[model samples]
Target: MPTPKPSILIQLDSDPQPSVFDGVVAVDSGVEHLFRHGGVQPDAVRDLVYGALFTRGPADLQRTAIFVGGSNVAVGEAILKEVTKTFFANFRVSVLFDANGCNTTAAAAVLAALEGAGGVLNGVSTAVLAGTGPVGQRVARLFGRLGARVALGSRQLDRAQATVEMLGQVNGGRFTPFSTSDEDSLANGLAGVQVVVAAGAAGVTLLPEQVRRSLPDLKVAIDLNAVPPLGIEGISATDKGIDRGGVRAWGALGVGGTKMKIHKRALQELFTANDIVLDAEEILELGRTTLG
Candidate 1:
């Protein structure tokens, strides 16, 4: 009888508790022998990655993979860099960086917004509230890559600009920064926008129900906050494909199903190849395939 292929996944998380959400998804995606590490620092990634790299031979390396995640995308990114630095030639296992599920969540949210916008995203004027955040930054980046005129919003204009600059460095796409601290400012930032996505902090309302209802040009509205006083008010957590005032709206859970689907599909894609590194753009492409 042939020996069974090992399906081991090494999860390196920066949080104290290795994300229960990621763990559940990894298990559900058919990962066997998941080794989870919490409170992982960038400096410690070398040892952890080495552990995974050295244990399996090149041919058997497909059996092992790495997942970098945490609540903070910055730390997760630092860890991702360190993890990649440890890889040499064909001796590395496939690794995925989700960082609080930002990559998959943003991909799912973008996909939802495009669908809500009548299946058109190019040339659409879009605003990402709390655009300096991990998820918001990714959403803006993805939209910009898709040829959307993206406005990245933040409580402070400087921070938004910094995010826009950072995104430019990586993707060389155009992005506008706006301050959304007050109603007038947020309204101005969202003015003429066809798509509005609220990715603000938990339990904080970025766009009030009145504001969203009053928008004249808004065709799609999406909120990533599942907490009370959702990022975008007037949208229920369970709402999906609901039309309000001629605008399609999606709440957190509405987009969540898509996020979960993308997550699982990305994981399945990981196992298909030993050289795949599923990041934001790659994962977004996978999500787009699901749309068709």
Candidate 2:
């Protein structure tokens, strides 16, 4: 019998210190050896990627994978782009990018919304509050991928419009830009909205209790902020699908379990192949399988 090769995972992070959360999950998900790099820049990614590629033969390359993570998603994105630039025709290791947990978290939130909508979002009116940030935009993109009529809510119209424009169209999913600076604007913009995802910053309230209760058509409300004074006034941090004002509400921690699952699953899957880039859409597919 041949000796089995050990699975090796190289974690490249743009932060000063790599995330302990991600490190713990890597261990928990059965990564045999973990190599970590911190404060990585886009220009500096090629050497590290080259080390991974050159160390293993073509068949054993599948045992090695790359995990890109950091607190700043933009920086991580740059590093991801540079990492891909180092790949040749058939000499790339599988890579997973989940900067600040955005990919998995966005996937989980969208899955929660799908569960709320009875497993369908095609043509559904969905509003993503604070939808210009990293997680918010990715959440909007995922929903748009699912064929939802998405409205991106931001304090500034231009920022919201930028996010909508970045997404463009996904399988003809419509994206509308709206403002959430004031109650009147918020109320007016969110008219006839069936689902609301509050992805605002911590301690910032994007959707008030009154406005939420007044939405006659809102069937689901997900608040992704896990701090004091949550993104949605009536949502609890531990809420996993609790009913709030006749809406299925999910809190940050509620969706976090699924996010972690998708994260670990992505890690476990890396050893299976060396050609995949597990980004938002791929993570969403993992979320769908997890939820199913």
Candidate 3:
């Protein structure tokens, strides 16, 4: 009888820390050992990842895959590309990227909104607060692909415009730009919007309580901020798929349970096949299977 293959997880950090492994371990499985590093620059990650693949042996290396995530999505993207390019040169391992949990979490949040909204994300006018960030972009893309007119909001008009342009290139859908630095701007963006999502930084209030409460056409509201100060004013962290004022609300942690479940399932799904990119769109479809 052959010995079972040992699975390992390599965590590369731009800023090295021992605690970084905890974040990945909390949600993933089959990881026999976890390798962590900090202060890993783009130029060095290729060699680092390559070394891990070769040293793990073919069986272990075949089971080996890389997941890139960090506070900075750009940094995460750079590292992810390097790792993938290097691995493709000599190895057949898979790679996944989701900086700040943006891709996966955004997929989950939007799927929840679609579920709470009763079917298609099509023809819906949606506004995303703090829409310049990584998670926000993924949400906007997913919304656009599903047929929604998206208002990508940011404090800077340039950032909002950039996001709109990017989404057009990738998904080829109509997107509006909004600057939500003041109450009037936020309200203007939210006007006639059916779905609103707050995916800003932690503990920072972007959407006011009054705005969430007053929107008549708003059918679904989601907040992806888990820290002390909520992102969407009236939505509580505990409000998962809860209905309020004719609109359904979901908080960071509230939407997180479904995100975690989807993440785990996504990993298992990877092992069952050879070439699959489980980005926002695919992840949302997986979540839809369970929605009532």
Candidate 4:
């Protein structure tokens, strides 16, 4: 009889302190052992990955997993690429990159909006305000993947356009750049928008109540800021599927439940295969399938 292999999760974080929130979720997600590494750089990834790859045979590789996370998504992305480059053939472990809770949070938010829009996002016109950030870009990408005509809105039009062009290289979906800084820009960008997501920094108001009320085609509104002065003015941080002025609204806390679920599931899934990569699109699809 063979002893059962323990499931171990190695979390590599760019920040000086690895995320305690992620550690707690990994424990809750049934990871038997967790190795947390902070201040991780691309240079450190190869040694750690080699350690994960060499300690176990190919058959037991699924028991080990890698999670790349940090406050900065760019740093996390660099580390992820390094981790991938270390693997060849079946000498890899399943990995998930979700720095700053971007993938899970965005997945949950987009899934909420899709549900609010009658389970159909095809042909829906959507606007993702603050789309230059990690969560917002993912929201826009997910919406576009769902067949929505997505507008990536930002205070700087050039920044929004750059983000759109970056996302276009990976996905075949169409994304338009739009400005959402002022009243005129908001009105212009949000015209005929059926769904709106406010994924901005905390305490910064992206979409005002007046502008929200003015959009005739707005069917769903999602605000991912839980801090004081929520991102979307008219929506409460705790709102979930509440209809306010003919629009189904979802707040940060409202979307949090699903986000946590996706996070946990992504971690648990790491032990299921040694070849899967759980990124934005993969996490979005996972949430959608589980929710459905």
Provide the TM-score for each candidate, comma-separated: 0.96, 0.98, 0.89, 0.98
Query: What tens digits encode model 2's per-residue C-alpha lDDT throughout 1-292?
Result: 7576899999999998999989999999999999999999898999999999999888888999999999999999999999888999889999999999999999999999999999999889999999999999998998888889999999999999977887885435389999998999999889999999998888999998998888899999999999989999989989998998789999999988888889999899888988999999999997788668
Model 4 CA deviation exceeding 4 Å by range: none
Instruction: Find the number of clashing residue pairs for candidate 1.
Output: 0
Show the lowest summed lDDT stretch of 10 residues, model 3: 18-27
Worst 10 residues of 4 by lDDT: 167-176
lDDT winner, 1 or 3: 1
* Stretch of 10 with least lDDT, candidate 2: 165-174
Across 1-292, the per-residue lDDT of candidate 4 in tens digits comes to: 7786999999999999999999999999999999999999989999999999999999999999999999999999999999999999989999999999999999999899888988899999999999999999889888878899998899999999999999898678489999887988988999999999999999999998998888899999999999989999989999999999999999999999999989988898888889999999999888977777
Error of 1 at 178 (Å): 0.9
Local error of candidate 3 at residue 82 (angstroms): 1.1
lDDT of 1 by residue, 1-292 (tens): 6575778899999999999989999999999889999999999999998898888778888888889998988999999999888999987888888998999999999999888887778899999999998999999999988888999999999999999999888767678999988999988888899999999889999998888877899989999999998888888888887987788989999999999999988887777766888889999999999767
lDDT of 2 at 195: 90
Q: Global lDDT of each model?
A: 0.89, 0.91, 0.76, 0.93
Q: Candidate 3: where are CA atoms >4 Å away?
A: 18-28, 56-60, 273-277, 289-292
Estimate the lDDT of model 2. 0.91
Order by lDDT, highest first: 4, 2, 1, 3
